[model samples]
Target: MSGTGFWTPVFDIEKRGDGSILMRQNDPLTDHRPTLADALDHWAETAPDRPFLARRAPGGGDWRRISYGAARAAARAMGASLLTLGLGPDRPLLILSENSLEHALLGLACTCVGIPFAPVSPAYSLVSKDHRKLREIARTLRPGAVNADDPEAFAPALAALAARGRHVISNEDGPGRIGLETLRGGDPAGAEEARAGVGPETIVKYLFTSGSTGAPKAVINTHSMICANQAMVRDCYRFVAERPPVVLDWAPWNHTAGGNKVFYLVMTNGGTFYIDDGRPVSGRFDETLRNLREIACTWYFNVPLGYDLLVEALEGEPALAEMFFRDLGMMFYAGAGMSQITWDRLRAVARRTAGREVLLATGLGATETAPFALACTEVQERAGNVGVPARGLTLKLVPQGGKLEARLKGPTITPGYKGDPAKTAEAFDEEGFYKLGDALRPADPEDFTKGFFFDGRMAENFKLTSGTWVPVGAVRAALVDAMGGLVRDAVIVGENAPELGALLILSEAGAAMAPEAREAALAERLAAAARAATGSASRVRRALVLTEPPSFERGEVTEKGSLNQRQMRGNNAEAIMTLYDGGPGVLTF
Candidate 1:
């Protein structure tokens, strides 16, 4: 299938009399498998030897492949073992590690036999000084078993959790750990019997939200939710059915974007997934570049900053660019907005390398939605048009604070967060639609088919002393863009204040400059941005260079690098006060 043929854009929109809008895809969603295990069974039988998953060798040589048949066999054995260890829906397994073969197999095993497993973010264990979030998750889950790929590396976190009688699984044998081989030594007949009990309503996994706002809530993921989500994905990106998707992804599986969406996308389609060990950061991104040079993904995904770095690499290296665009069906970005600069550069690079423009798209969904509700496949000239609602979803846009608050009702939407009935009650509306807490603006007010742009987060936006509302998401994006690559991100603060101020997180370029030069450059850029703004609500009058990066422990940033504007503002209340007080180091426009 050609890149342009990936999606056929069609939407059905209805404007209600109550100043609300409803939208959905015209095409109805097709039947999907009852469970993801069903898909695994089918693929293992049909494409036994085909590579379903691959990862780089220990020291990074060639890709080590796991065939569908091998995966199914491992799942059965491991599933039986988990059952033997008294793990089930109530006392689930908790994974604490980066993406690895062991992690994938363990997750698959849990899903196959209806044992709900939670892949907690490794940062909570490794990066945090106190492992506070990890302990919190442990308390919430009360997991029967815990798997840490390297027992030695995660020993401190494991100690913090104080796993006394819990089953400890690891890649290598340790003092009190069960090795992967031991898990794979169980009887397959037991797993078969357990699999018979698994159905659509069976809980598959628990994907925890980044606890930026508060303690991470375990979003309940069921077999039905994931299978239906993959069905929606296949319906939209029809090319996946034509040619099984070949994806190389690095997004952590703890988030729904990766664990449910991308992970199941490959499994349902019988596609190959190359687990890229590289990340988008300075030291780790080179591994991604090296992987891209060898593997050409049919469908690609990255955050905006990842694309920014990738475009730079692609522009400078022709071979890398060619390899990247080859066999590429589409590119996707989420978690944050892509700057127009990065968008244009990516399109240009693709056109130059592949002789055509590939589909560069963004979408709006959340952990509760199985993260595949509304996707934009249209070749947008600019960024932030999150297309229309997918089939099997009813998108409700309720007017609130001069913006449309996006809500969704679908099979893909999670039933509720686990172990928190109060939070779940607050999540849905009277009509049972999950409120996204995000506001959207129609790309064209007269035509709903033109798609919707992410206006801002309703929770993030605040009013100034002048009574004008400031859209923090939009303002922060504009400020980062206006800084001309000098600022990576910003926390906008001006709730009930005379004007807006920002705590700017510097980009690599900005950080490398001398203190005086950096201050001057930021001041000039801030002046330019203020002059360009049409109102006090949008203008940022002052800013302070945030020398310290957002801390994961502090809930100032997510694993995907999205800033918690509310948390940051509260964490740096003194700094924000200084900006308003015209203290030293405050750069005024």
Candidate 2:
């Protein structure tokens, strides 16, 4: 049944002093429009000279910016470049690159025309050694142009495809490859009119899922879906004409959160987008710190691990904290839930620096729905409540068998994956709604308007020997949240074991300082957290903090730096047994 056309319920979202529900209002925007093309057209006509992208080199000197006019011109030129290569709407562009100004330009260009561009993980280009998955992707979509962010290896990766000969373009050119700069130099771009009459329903980009657990699927996105979501997100954040926010972000554009959501949010609001070349891991994070030292940004977004490291560094230097908080409006976070310890530390530091609590908000989203479906916006808190759905989004949690499953219907939802109608057909329900596959029971289901926490994926959740179904994602998140800096991530034991156990990996920094002593201290803290855990269902009764790194040559760990859980367990079966049976470092009673 069609529930309602549009409804925003104001239910009790917060808890009162007496632990009762407190009324929190949620009113959807009255002027919700659903198209990215219209938003850009409006912004271009209204404020053409406003800086849309502000970026700098690694050393953090002066910022380079591109205005609305320049952005539009570059997009058209790139679109012209796509057509010059004999590409069309039928065949999508395969972009394998990192987050950069050029990547953003090409993405916007694809939207200008009806040509769909799919940006795959750079791991597929440089990291993934197997090449099986990358080869499979090439087989599915015989890409016309492969734009490798890297100049050296990217061209070769694209050339690995059989029919991909003579159509590969590299942003960099050294030995023998076509350069992106070379393409933009020869043409005045007379193909601007060819891109006219493009509408919201046009397929803009195809984003592949990370597939940490299994095979990746290309999530198709359209202009209408992203633009509509962008409108609601921009309005909710109050990014409007009068006062524009300055953003300092370094998240990979391959992910929809950074590419579609934040990118469009900045463009739609006419704000300045300062692109950071730094990454969360490696020595690049130092570049982020150096960048923060120079410019005063209104908004900053990063992952929880990145935030923790930055905060640790900020505690030592007050001058750095001064530069950070000088004109900062809010510090946004995403990717993973902020642990309670991390959240508390952030809140304390924010209060110390800002003289009040500066909000650290996050959201729940996927690559499928323009990377933003739910967020914590209206009110500020450290807890994990991803707030209500956006203006046009309609969420329904249907109980199938015994678990509550979440389904969504809106313009922001993707039409389907590129050239895979069978998989796409399996993704939706009978009512034509996109099946999210994950379950979502209201935080307090009695008062449904309070919003919902993401229950575990239906496929991932498995039943214990006692016949009790375990929500893996929620339990994993909760345990990791409790462990904080001591454990980087975990492998939930007790799949067939008698009791719950964990294979813990210490944070690199935490492990570096007096490794043995730190492990001892962490063992005690972990024991305490386990003892304090709510129930036996998820509690990690014993844990083993892994000291040695998983070998890359053995394929136990991927080049993307993620552990293959099943492989890891098999590789370290003795340690898993030790942790399971409470053998050596079992500090908990």
Candidate 3:
């Protein structure tokens, strides 16, 4: 309602009088193509010279670009080669690499020919000391071909696999490796045949879940699910088609946020994507800052930690801030909830720089929902407002254990998890609605149209020894905001204990302070926050600063930079005990 002409907010909400609400977009869903490859072909013919993707050369040389026509031609050649390699649904392509122009092109090539591909997180292969998870994933996928950017980087992982007959491809040739140029050197004879076989039900890719509770399961992504989700996105944010979206992103393609949402959002709209080399972490964020100074993104997205760092940079650098918001229409945060403090600072910085307010929004979705189910387009200053259900999606809120559990049934929802029929059977309800396991409450209790605030994950919320249920998501966001810039994230502990506790990940500001000063400052902030608390659940009694970062291999932190609350608590049981044991370095309220 308070935004510019780029987008007009619209939603319809109906109350059933039984504490349940029905919400949908006012705009009707547009008829999208059956597959993503069709959209690429359309753009290639209509705007052959428009830039589709761009990335800096290795070691930060010149910017490399691939136009729509060039990308289409390369994809066709790659698809033809894959067909000859006998890669299809049963024997698919497995990609293990970071985000690159080649990664994007190869991913598109797989889709063009209906060749199912799974871009597994490079962490499983590159970071872990033992490639157990990667082996399990490759075994489950039974891939006919494996691809990586650098064969030397993934040499150990590649060696662990049973690679007698599998085709190995990389940018540069190595032992038993076929170069990328050679792979795509084949003619486009089989390209048309592959594209003609694709339909709405054709399998496009396999997106793996975080596996916070267990082994990661591959969620089947169909062409219909992805295409329909983009239609809903276009209906919600109308400015995308008006001008080609320019996006700078670093989120890994293994996750749906970057791989499906941002990647396809650009492709489906005939937009340009710049692969961001900088991440939101402390050491890597400088690349993001440098990119923001050069490219004025039409739409921007980052996790909460990234936003916090950007806010600090924007407060100091006026030139960078101006370039960042020059043509920006909306700023979005996901992979986790954004704190109110970060949200306020971002809006203030944008207003100061752009001389007009920009929409700061967040949405609710999961890997199973093609990663887009609800989006908030309303103008609000606070965080935690995940907007109404997307167009063409049916959202059913059921009351469970004193919370509203969200479920989805639509074309965008995944059919089920791959290679896990038992888990799939347990995933849906009797009505065939996929249980999302997240809880939500109405943003405005009296007005159902206002949207909903994320409560907490059903499995993450725990009961104290006093029989009080603690909403981890709400409490963690409140505590982090209350602590100001001291804490980046937290894991709320005290399951079956008397009171709540937290393991805090220090922010950049907090980490910059001297050891003694940091401890004293944290104590002061903890006391202030505890004084302002109103309930036992909101009141964090004891806190411990995490000395070590969460490990990706341990499942404590997901590749998307989201903390796995349950996994974190379970992995650090000794730390929790030490805090409760009245140990040193533990601040008590």
Candidate 4:
């Protein structure tokens, strides 16, 4: 499919004398709203009765919606209540809950009243036994107020924060807890006064990075950064401005992809957002499938695994496929590299169902770039091409260890990490570009505008015994794709060894097979992959299947399900040694 009406794909590239390259879009960013409050006010006045947010009703018969005017009123009253409780830029609100109507309202209230808020991942509270990360986050922010939708479910986490003299708010009334209803009854005039103080530079929120390596850093997000990102989004996906986008997304708001990108994408475009109460997991994915059958999203986003599951459903159920692709303008995947099998399946299913090709694309960005820096809008035969930099941003590709390391400077970039001046200083280079720590390879070396492929994470790639650098990201993706359906993900090992090895995480299909059959299947697949590999640096000579999955609490896996390669290797040192030793259960290629 051509990005004829969707994208204005043009770029200006420059090669520097210092062996670096700079790239940016030819056009400039158009004017955008100074603050999110302005967007809420505009939509409320113009489209009073339009549904702005929706969620599954308690019993799940129908969707309960909140209109633009009603949402604005609720936000104003909540903002007034927040101010009365002494919440502001310095002492922000800390939210520990999943995506819900109340969560959305509380976030809007904070933006409206110039009170910076941080919505943390629910896993830190619900999944962890020790709540170590939660305690670290509380210490970092020193928030004055905290909110958890269900006080009973989050009682332990709330107690941990309350011990530090933080105020607790919940939907249910309890001893020493503020009820959500009480916040909704505050005077709107107080909120209106607070809104006047908010400007472009005012802090909107703090989106914490995924603490894959260590404690998560709080990335400061300002009103200008988010608004400029939406402007760039509109310029690239121009069809969104033609009509209000209808999105049903399940990605947690704690991350930038959903928090800043998808959330504001709906709000800034005057679109309707359906908070999906489903996840891309075994038991939870059925809810997502049910929701997709009912809501035809104009713009859809998901991880590669979700697309793999979705393609199976779309191919089997024609009615569900019809509803899904009915008004679908585009499909986007990120967080991991998608397999060519899944990519081809999605395109074929869409063509068979819709009778026309739908744009399937991906991008590359970080939490600091508001997560929309480089987006691919053009048609492609396979996945892995993250297109050029967006408008209003300058991408600097600096030479680093045989790869072009990506660094960016732009209005959409976060100013710095909260309360960590030293770490923040290390984040940017002397030229004032935020170091992304990712390496890129141009798709077409002769034509820079063709876009670039994610080479690998600079920190993850390592040298082999022969001094050849092994790109772990590429090798891992290739291995998983080659394994067909036997493995879900692979952790590449052999940092200083003669060749590469992998610790495999089995897929559902692999786990269901008999022990001997599974081993044979793995050996056959690994041999085939090794034969097809380009060189020793890319080949996997041996493999061992991990009996246990990556633990969230152990920091082996991120909330987005991307494995932390370093953490995984460190946690499984014994397994690596066993694989190299050709021990029992290790498949030798």
Candidate 5:
């Protein structure tokens, strides 16, 4: 096949009974279970009537249900349709869609038929006007089929590839585009009957990183990698080892947390996954709240923003409090650093509802590692320390300056970046371990039993005018913890400037506190707290309360919910300039 294409695994996937597909290979990791296809197939056999895909619509209503049996049928049908197109293991199909029940089914279809599918971010399509990232994605995937579910935006790009041997599938009705309705209606029975053999190492999907450095790189995820990461995280947390887990989350499928961790965790255990259609914006969160009332999740996960909003809803509603507590396994928060004030409320609610506080743990993972690298199982009164490496994973601390950088070696880890050899080289060490780029020495050099505290990224720290290095993550976490929940998050300013200062976002509830009442108010209390916590060169002198939330589409926040420091300064140039000009103690305008 040409000189040498990308690395394709020698192993393959085979369809098991019901909806699952079993892997037919042996490896260093856990004895191979079902392929992604096998995992979903198992759900169909064991729990056919269970609601596998529970989704809330755009408007507020009860959950629209898709059972395990139906999901398996859809995947088989979609897989068959994929085969009828003549695409195989060699050539891949790329899905350009957002997180939806349909997206999940489409992905399963790829797994069933051995076609690699990728769910791209809406930013690279509908939200992104220029399509700069979308253009690069096309160059990277060179897909045989461009699934343009959003043709109002993707039609032009699909048209550009019209002669280049790329097929275009549209949303409803677009000229020269095969509508998804039509594709769905077309006899999936043919494709199901056509299915003969599939593989475990068969690449089921590709997800591109936001790629702040340059062009985003495509992460190649095989069925084995996803299954391994899913199994590892599940075993550590023991979220639902007894029975299948019932989860409610809305994190995008384009990222590892949503795509591999949440999706696979639900599928592997034969759990019911309810996609929270609510976004953290106006009018969207209601749908998420409705789902919470309808079905209590044994496992719950959300970014800090989603949790912050949900806590408010839970506090006000008695029914929600009862639903949240009863049969809830554990509540987990990730995607960004969490604040203590928000952390406290979660526990308070847990205690009131369950008569005992449930564990509110934070973990770490990236799109490259298939998402679950480090996580916390037990409930902690404090924040910031994510537990040790997952089972079957090895960690190393390479000394870099005053800190030791974290790197990992594991079967769950991706082989390398797809289609980019230069990135592949830089991502790994001489021994071929993936360099995590997080500069945090293990708390115990002798034993990782104590676990690792995130020191900061090796590259994130910067020097002041006094030539002192400021560890941003250490300072950021400490400052937030110090202010309690009043000051939610702060962006450490002053790289070669006079002093360290912050541009802070206030808690939604905290921000509502009366500023005139200085003693008990959030702003005044936080200022006092921030003043007391400052070290010699690291203290935040003046904090300008953030009037606006960071925008994802505006590039102020990364896909992982981390603030893009470089982009922040550029986008808020006026705000940064005001800090130097000395307008007010807090900049609201």
Candidate 6:
């Protein structure tokens, strides 16, 4: 446990000696309830007064908390109202805003009545210029109702999808919109009967994929998948169930980690969740800092970008660091691999502030696996170690191409994508394992107990003009880390080209520097990084700074902020051409 009162590492691996390997935790899984509503019911009865969910007031005024009992009462009323609207399995509810108190309650209301709900990325409805993806999603889901926090904000999207024969719900009613208060004022006569009907197989929600490649597919999330996943998380963490968890989260609920994993993690454990308005992006992280100063989280989670910004904040302010570690149990990162430098900085800050090292860890999973399949409970120094599979899950490493492809099979695994049976069939192998399209490499060949590292996404790798394959994940990580704080994230270019290139999104630190200084610093770092590389595949010879952030509407980035390399390259064809054509801003090795 690294003397930090976090998890203790205990991993085991069984090699079949054929071409496959299996890895899992040594501990058994805890008994899980059939549905998420059951967990809510249990906690509502036991810890009625505990704060279950909270969000900042409008304009970030103050925090508003909802007790478990209050939440259940509101959800029952809302669920009954939804039933009156003719919403069922076929006509699901769709939420189009960021996380909020109403969002949580309404999501629970749908699940309580065995009515499915889908939360799509807010960017699709709000940020997209043409509303292309939003229209496509509306056509695909055919939602019976749509909820948004602010009607004025999503007015365009709501009007565009109005012809789908659905009700538009808003906290504040506008023209042709239903008010939230109306739903809360409904009778709870059918709530108990509806709750009783929910079981493990009941479809609770649909979590859409990031759609980094093509059109996003809705991943079916059942009651069993969420409950079993929470069980795996509870068994792995071991300390979460002991006390009420307090989390300050900024990740959007449209994705799995924030939606099912973190939200349910807090709900199942009788925890208090503070929805952070501050994202990890520039000019918004200050909101996160404000929240952290007030709330001492028991468990913390952030992306590598958030941690990079936070490490600096923690280092500069001792009082803030003290407040942060006051009740922190463990620090976790996800959505992408964290750098070893960032990992070291985090541990050092923990040791400095708390007088002992805190457990810094990460895990591996996908939207299809309920997103909590594999976890690293141990304390390690290296980055990208995703540890072993969870207690109730199976990890199969089948040799494919030159890497071991990861496959999963468990109660938490999704049955199939919504409305896509053929695509679902192609997602799994003959043995009924969900083929995760990701590759893994053993950290220690002889001792699998050391865990495994994420090799690269099989679908993301590409061949150079020399016929040599490039592992984009590893190369991107190395390049991003090597550029120091200059690059936030990068999309590897030069697929089928002579040498590798990069389209870099500058970090806040990089953007803050003087123009000339920024370019010089970036160019020097790129040259040094390229000079240190041993092969053409690893070395980046040309680079271009991406001035615009990745467009969610264009599918250049996922809602979780992961880059889609192919999409980025294809979308920025002109930039790549300019780089090779000796453009003015191009940096060369």
Best by TM-score: 4
**C-alpha root-mean-square deviation, each candidate:** 1.5, 5.4, 1.7, 1.1, 8.8, 1.9
The best candidate in terms of lDDT:
4
Model 1, span 255-348: residue lDDT tens:
8888888988998999999999999899999999999999989999999989989999999999998888889899999999888878888998
Residue 138 alpha-carbon offset, candidate 5, angstroms: 0.9
Of candidate 4, the 10-residue stretch with the lowest lDDT total is 1-10
Candidate 5 local lDDT, residue 281: 51
Give me the runs in candidate 4 sitting further than 4 Å from their true place: none
Go through the candidates in order and give the clash count of each. 0, 1, 0, 0, 12, 0
Residue-level lDDT of model 3, residues 64-123, one tens digit each, is: 999999999999998888888889889888999889988888898899998999998998
| Per-prediction TM-score | 0.98, 0.87, 0.97, 0.99, 0.86, 0.96
How much is 132 displaced in model 1, in angstroms? 2.2
lDDT of 5 at 99: 72
**Weakest ten-residue segment in model 5 by summed lDDT:** 1-10
**Ranking of all candidate structures by their lDDT, best first:** 4, 1, 3, 6, 5, 2
| TM-score sort, best first | 4, 1, 3, 6, 2, 5
Instruction: List, residue by residue over 1-589, the lDDT tens digit for candidate 5.
Output: 0001111112233343432222222223445474777777777988899888877655655568899998888777767766777666655777777777777777777787788887887666666666677778777777777776677766655554454667676566567666655656646666654344566577778888887657888887877788888777655656466678889888888888888888888888888888877776547788778778878888888888777788889889978989987988677777667777778888898899888767777777777788888765545666666766676666666656666677777777787777998898899988777887786645556545545678877666777888787788888877777765666567878778777777777765467777654224545555565567646356776667667888766667765467766566667777777886787655321
On a 0 to 100 scale, what is the lDDT of residue 472 in model 6?
87
lDDT of 2 by residue, 159-210 (tens): 5654734366667554655676765653435455656757667777778765
Distance from true location, Cα of 103 in model 1, Å: 0.5
Tens-digit lDDT track for model 6 on 1-589? 2233434546567788777987666766668888888888998999999998888888989899999999999999999999888888899999998888888888989988989999988888888777776777777788999998898899898887887469888886668887889899889887778878889999999988866565678999999999999988887787898888999998888889999899999998889999999998779999999999999999999998889889989999999999999988889898787766788888999999999767788889999999998777777877788887888787889987778999998889999988788899999999899999888887888877667888888988888999888888889999998988788899898887999999899887888999899999999999999999989889999999988888877778776677888888899999999888879899999
Off by over 4 Å in 3: 5-21, 26-28
